[model samples]
Structures are given as structure tokens and as C-alpha cells.
Target: MINETELIEQLKRGDDTAFRTIVEQWQDMVYNTILGIVQNETEAEDLAQDVFIKVFEKIGTFKGDSKFSTWLYRIATTTALDHLRSRKRKKRSGFLQSLSGSGGEEKEQIPDFHHPGVSLDNKERAAVLFKAIDELPDNQKAAYTLHKLEGLSYRDVSEVLNTSVSAVESLMSRANQNLRKQLEEYYNKHYR
Candidate 1:
């Protein structure tokens, strides 16, 4: 097994094999991180590719102060957030254009995102949960998703989020409370 130091050196030297190895090792983590935030398979796939591109381009700047995965997670998270922010801008502009009776197209409805990591019996519940997650503040969403969904430890999550573990815990607490409220409202509205 190649040590991380060796892998980093290989990557820094622009070895195609080293880059491919890194991608193979880390692709799932990257994909899941983006998917957890972006909540769309197609967009997640595209953004995962984008993450690797950025990783290759910026590999030289990676200081060894943290675990390689943590650094990669930071990159993935930032890329996903940027994609989401840009999409939000486009959506808002589209809404405004439509309201102004310009030649804007109607808004496209995003289907409930079902996580591939979920089991068949849990798909519905997961979809509902994802909707609630989508409504969370970005910090809370990142904390919850990285910890609960991606199975990162609090310390790992803190490193990825660049916050203290206690902060991650607080964000997770708020996430759970908010999720409970959102699910309760959903159930009351639809299942009553």
C-alpha cells in the first residue's frame, strides 16, 4: 500500500497513475459529500469531476498540516457550495425574469432526491429527510451531512469545516432539532 506521503509526492510530480489512484481511493467520499449537499445525482457526478480537477490543479498548495482526506473534503465541500450558490442565483434570476413577463422559462421542479446510500425500505424516509436537510442553514447542513451521512467523526468534521468539534456538535444539535420540526410539519401536513 502506498503511504500518503508517497502518493502526495507522486501527485505533485504530475504522475497520471498517482492521480488516478488518488481519485479511485477518494472518489466515493467526494461524490457523497457533493451529493449530500447538492442532492442530485447528475450534478453530484459533474461536481465530483470538478473536485478532482481542482485537486489536480491545486495539489501543489496542499500543506501536510491535516489528513489528506480532510483536505480533500474541504475542497469538495467548497466546490459543492459554489455550485449550489450559482444555481440559486440562476433560479432567482429566472424567477425575477418570469415575474417581469420577460421571455424567461418556467422554473423546473426538482424531484425529491433519494440517496443512493439508503436502503430500499428507507428511500422514502431518506427523501423526506433530504428535503429537510436542504432547508438547513449551510453550516448545520454541512455538519450534519458530514457527520451523520458521511460517517465522519466530529474531529474530522471539524477539520473539514474548519471549526471546533464543539461547534460541530452544536451545529449537529440544531440540525437534529430542525430536522425534527421539519419532519413533524411534513407529517402533519401530508399524513394527517
Candidate 2:
């Protein structure tokens, strides 16, 4: 198999095979990262696919300033956030059509993720955690997901999120505090 630099060079020259190579190499990371954002099997799949599509479409614009994975993830995060915003806009529009006392209810159901490790039952809990993540501000959500979920170093996360290392740390700290508060509420409601 060709190495990343050769693959990228081919991709820059508009080679479809090279694009596929990049996708095959990094699709798992893209999927997992998108899953962390969208949290639905189908939506995550579509978003992951969409990231590759965008990469292929825009490969010429890539100037090789960073690792390919980092660039791909930046695209994935922006796409997922765009998806979230569109969904929210749709919900808002639907709410406007609802009768009085019906405007406050949301149709989206955030699942529960009580387990962080590998447990079959933890899928539901993981879903819950993802929902809480979606609720966070973009910076906090990006920092938390990049560092905690994606297992990137703080420096890597800062690069991905386009912030300083210190800013990333603070974002993560606030994210953790916010997550703790949200998870505690969930626990109290369900297990207490």
C-alpha cells in the first residue's frame, strides 16, 4: 500500500483510488467521531460518508499544513455541527406550528449511557452521554469529544479545535464540570 504522502499526492492529482485509500485508512476515526456527535446509527453513517465526500470534493484545497486525519476531523466536526443546527432549526419551525402548551416538548430522545467501558447495557448510557455532549457549547463539546472520547492529547485537541493548549484545557475542565452536573442529574432521576 502506498504511504500517506504518496496517497495525498495522488488525491491532489484527482485520483479516485487515492481518495478511497484515504477513506479506508481513516473512515473508522471519522465514523466514531461523527457517532460521538450525531449519536444515531444511520445519521452517523451518513455523516461519516459525507465527510469523505467533502474531502474528495475539496482535496485540492488541502495545502498539507497538518496531518490528513486532523484535516478530515475538522471537516467531520463542522459537518456534524451543521447537521445539529439544521435539526434544531427544523424543531424550532415545528414548534412554531404547535398549539399552546405543546411548544416546549422536543421530539428527539437522548439515550442513556451509564457505562463508559465495554458493556452491552452501556450502549444506552453511552447514548445519554452523547446527548449531554450535544447540549454543550461548541467549544466545550469539541474539546471534550476530541480529548475524552477521541483520546487525543490536549495539544492535538487544541490543533483540531483551533485553540491554544490552555484554552483547550479550560474548555475541557468546564466540559467535565458540566458533564458531571448533567450526569449526576441523570443518575438522581434514574438510580437514586
The lDDT leader among the candidates is: 1
Over the stretch 63-117, how does candidate 1's per-residue lDDT look in tens digits?
8999889999999998988898899899898898988899666668779998988
Question: What local distance difference test score does each model get?
Answer: 0.92, 0.80
lDDT for position 6 in model 2: 91
How much lDDT does candidate 1 score? 0.92
Least accurate 10 contiguous residues by lDDT in model 2: 109-118
Worst 10 residues of 1 by lDDT: 103-112
Q: Which one wins on TM-score?
A: 1
TM-score of each: 0.96, 0.87
lDDT of 2 by residue, 74-183 (tens): 99888888898898898777777564555655565555533334477767767667767877987788778777768999998887877789999899889989988998
Q: What does the lDDT read for residue 118 in candidate 1?
A: 95
